[model samples]
Target: MRKNIMNRLPVILPVPAPPPPAHRAEPVLDLAVPVFNEEADLEPSVRRLHAHLRETFPYPFRITVADNASTDATPLIAARLAAELPEVEWIRLAEKGRGRALRAAWSASSAPVVGYLDVDLSTGLTALLPLVAPLLSGHSDLAIGTRLAPGARVVRGPKREAVSRCYNVLLRCTLSVGFSDAQCGFKAVRRDAAARLLPLVRDTGWFFDTELLVIAERAGLRIHEVPVDWVDDPDSRVDLLPTALADLRGIARVGLALARGALPSGRPSRSYAVPVTVMALAHLLLYAALRPAAAAQAVNALSLMACWVLAQPVLGRPPLPAPPALPALAARLAVTAGSLALLRHAAPGAGLRAELAVLAAAHLSLALPVAVARSARGGRRCRTGSAAS
Candidate 1:
């Protein structure tokens, strides 16, 4: 019986001890300095960055020279630097956007913490460790060096200072973003957080930072801000006017998307039915009162503006972003104009009362959905704020 049992039993083979958790060494921090046509600045900036990290930073660090389609000797300098310094490496791209370069370098990094500052190193190197430490220690999902922070010391011309302040104010009014400085080039993020947020960030240009921060804030991520001593680089290559215009366009896109519930903040709870009805009635009454004294189009325009002004306070604490506002205004105007045209053609002898009634109905129809969507969004924000508190 024993012999038969042994013959039936299968031989137990030792499973080769699972390959000892492949001791893969990942850098603790990856600092990306993106450049475009910066042949003169590349070597000096990279070397200075390397020296600082080697002397002060107390972790495994790497300096990545992200060249954004520089049609100069920048690539050659970067290559030489990479070959010379074991801790430095170079990546070349066929595109020319700061955002594009950052996205590429950060996405490809195997490090736990990835960050970037402008090639000019406008932000002082002393702030580098603080910027990355929170992310590394898991205390925060992201960190930014803010020039506008209380303790920050900024040295720049009055024009640049004013522009920066105005831009931030615009962000607060338009997007309700809490971050003081959105355009600060010195910033860092954890790899895991970046993996989740990078895909949702659409702007591959100057507005990329603002879009990312706004989305992250809405998504309920903890952001750390470090007051940085930043000196404006006299040789800044940025074209302010073009960049500002692009940023405005970006704000519009992002704001509209947020208002329409296209992004991940979730649908708001409040209904706009009552508000819409009341506002529509008020708008119609206003149009009727003005019709006798003004042209149909002029009356419609005044009534529309009045409705917007009246609705603004009730909609929320701060006014809606320009993107959403512009569309709603456009829709109302289009409806009002179309209605006036059709009524004039169909009923050439239509009375003032009849015309006003028709125009009011048109305005109501267009404004109702917009009002409802915006009210609901406001409610969502309120709930979010309360919960956060």
Candidate 2:
């Protein structure tokens, strides 16, 4: 049997995320800081974050230092912080992927809300409240701190800025997504939403963040965006080329899934056999009523289009496909036109039975493969780690 990848936790983390912060009631929010080799910065960062949360946050909070296969003193630093602070805890994973670390930490969190922040703290801490407020108040399913949104301030090299803008634009143009930024490290989710979305997100690296947000949006969960003040971390370990290439591949994978209406919604997808039968029957009745050749052909075309729409499927909370996007809508129309044209120009003398046959043959052969799917809420693709999240 192909066992779930999430079960293969680093031996060091035989235990899950740290026990509820000792002495305090269970936290309302748990902040995950996923790290690899950051001995020089982890301790101070955690301390700084702890101080900020203690001073500003209204409710109890927990900080989990998720060290993913660090080869340096990072684990030691994280352990020390966990030992010294009542609100702090740490976990060590065997693998180095950030997505893997987050999966482990977030999956084990008990708080009503769970979120992650990069250890470098590139985004200012002030946005933290707005980030979680929506989830806490039951106004939003997820909250994100976006550098690309209006009123946000960002200081990054031109290259990074360009890449960020381009990547977001690609998401808008290809996926027709509403969120301005997909990979912002500063984000939080209501536990219930996370529980539903996590298992379906597939990427295990940087793309993990984007995948999670995409799934949340597609599932009809509300997302609140916070315009954050951010400063670029020069020491950031992310390699632009590899990350960008990976993101492109991720986009393509997701786009194809949306196009096929194959995104898993954590439910059993219904068979379309019934819808097709209904469509065929409806077309016959409509054509019988509108006997003029052009009108009868039009009726046949409309029924086929309706069948295509009803058959589009996406795995989601509603187990519904996104309304088709422009390309898809166009494709469906073109096919409908071609099908009607064929019956009119090629088989003008055909009887009613022959017309029905040709209509069915045209749609089965030409239209079903190409069209009807993915609205602005285009299906979000979930990958491996996320796929089993």
Candidate 3:
């Protein structure tokens, strides 16, 4: 019986099976070093970065050299470094803007966290881990190494420092931006956040950082600031005046867009009582001041019109979803006329004091709800627009 069973199984033969597909781990970080024409600093900086990352970095990483239309030997040096280092890569772009290079490199990378630092490596490498850790752990959507932050140590001349401070102040006053430093080169963004933001950013030059931050803030994304020890690179090729002028132009454009409600925000709605009260007080004061000089009807009409004009940018136009522009204007005109009529009727026998009081109260009661509704609408629009984008 044993012999018969062995004969029955005689046709079976052992055949080799193919090996399973290899599982390759994705890189956790892609640090881009964008350069225009830094042939001399390219190799040394990359080698130093590679060494630092290799020694202390806790995860897999890659160093990308983004050469943006370099006329010298930068491309050659970058290629040589990429060839020498397994974790290094090079990308050559036809354009010359740091923003363009960074955008291209980051968009092409598959890493979960993509970041770029100045080729000069003016920022201390010790901050590298802190800069990316928030993004990796999902504690923040973006992280920036801020030289202006309180704990930061910065070494730069008086002129550069003054310029930096003044620029930031201008941003606060004009754009109402919350970020401390917008021009810092040491910045990182999660790939998902970058995908949503990069399309909305219009600047392809030095102002790119500011544009990115402004849009991100408007979209209600959380930004993490890391104080860094930084040394100014004396060999930097940036022209101060031209760059400043360009940045100002960019600011003006962005500010105008924001005023027109063209740029949307993602922040939650807040109590409108304070702003509404302030506007009401201001409006009352304006009417009182003009009451003695102008006719009652004139003063009332002017004050109401002035309030509407001033509030257009703050509360936004078409505060409610109503009819077309012509009809809206007509409705506003009618409302203003009715308000004046109501004021006249309320104080027909009383003095100017009584009339002004009645006028203020009536207008406040009517405008407060409108203002609140407008604010709420604006907030909703911001969230909706951000989501759609």
Candidate 4:
């Protein structure tokens, strides 16, 4: 988040380009291939993708080679391809970051559905249609090729695989993200969605992908995931340790931003985090303090009930919500009452430690889902207000 949000805007304005001849159809999908120092792989990958799109893709498509400060022959090759292929174009940037390349090219694309693919082409090109179909049809705000989802066939080394899983798990636990994969290079977004989200995103490096998705999810945009066939690039140049460390820092930054409600969304800020945490500790202490006077189950029930009553006011929504089919007030009462009774009976003979664990688990399980639900619901009211500037 260190980068100025103002620096990220201004790219969305109309970009200069040579006007095509009359009767030349506008591309429905504009795919950006971000590259850096990949002279050898650039040509073949671009050609392969072009050929594949030409042979199989139903609608008109454009392939963009986004050269991000590559010192090698990559720029020359990209230029040649753009001049040779009618559907190919190239964008030059002085900086070196995948996110920079994407933002420059994606922000300038004329196509309604814009996406990016890694220059290595590790993901199967066969999944391209499925990836962008939703965005093209206006069914989803964004789509990503997921390697972790069911039916996804991926071939990669164990170490990278472990790191990928751990990174995603950290997102889930810390950020409450709904999407399965974050770093996958194969992703697409509607032009309007990108217009709204890019201004809010500050990371112009590896963290850009995650920051975009987090903002999208919090804004309650519909994100579509397509299980894909992926193969690891054997000669990939990315250094995992440095990248992983950077990603951790990015997560912490985004988490803090969300807590302060710095983002422009309807989702509640996590200002209650401190007070709520203190409340939990106090509840536990109250139970322990009363242990000498009452049974464990009685103390548990009383402490939990007191906390529930206090939460109504602490949450700032004094009146409970009204559910569509079920009464919100009744549902809340039933759930709270049922959870307490079960907590009382679930560990009747257990020691202090076990009972406390059960109490904490039930509370967490109940709370986490509500937090996630609120995040998702915020998307429906997602706004790209000028407040971000």
Instruction: Name every residue pair that clashes in candidate 3.
Output: none
What does candidate 1's lDDT look like per residue over 36-101, in tens digits? 889888888888999999899988787888877776777667777877777777787777888888
What TM-score, over all chains together, does every model reach?
0.67, 0.66, 0.66, 0.67
In lDDT terms, how accurate is model 4?
0.77
Residue pairs of candidate 4 with colliding backbone atoms = 219-379, 220-379
Residue pairs clashing in model 1 are none
List, residue by residue over 106-212, the lDDT tens digit for candidate 3: 99888999999999999999999999999999999999999998999999999999999989986774566789999988999999999999888889899999999
CA lDDT of each candidate? 0.78, 0.73, 0.77, 0.77
Tens-place lDDT digits, model 2, residues 309-329: 544442112334433444554
Which 10-residue window in model 4 sums to the lowest lDDT?
A: 317-326
lDDT of 4 by residue, 1-389 (tens): 31343244232222223566788899999999989999889999999999999999999889988888776777767777887788889887877998888999888888999999999999999999999989988999999999999999999999999999988986776677889999998999999999999999988888999999999998889999999999999999989977976786677567656755677765544544423443444455566667678876677667756754554444442122423322433443355456556766775566656655655555566566666776676554465343454
- For every model shown, the clashing-pair count is 0, 8, 0, 2
Q: Which ten residues in a row have the lowest lDDT in candidate 3?
A: 9-18
Clash count, predicted structure 1: 0
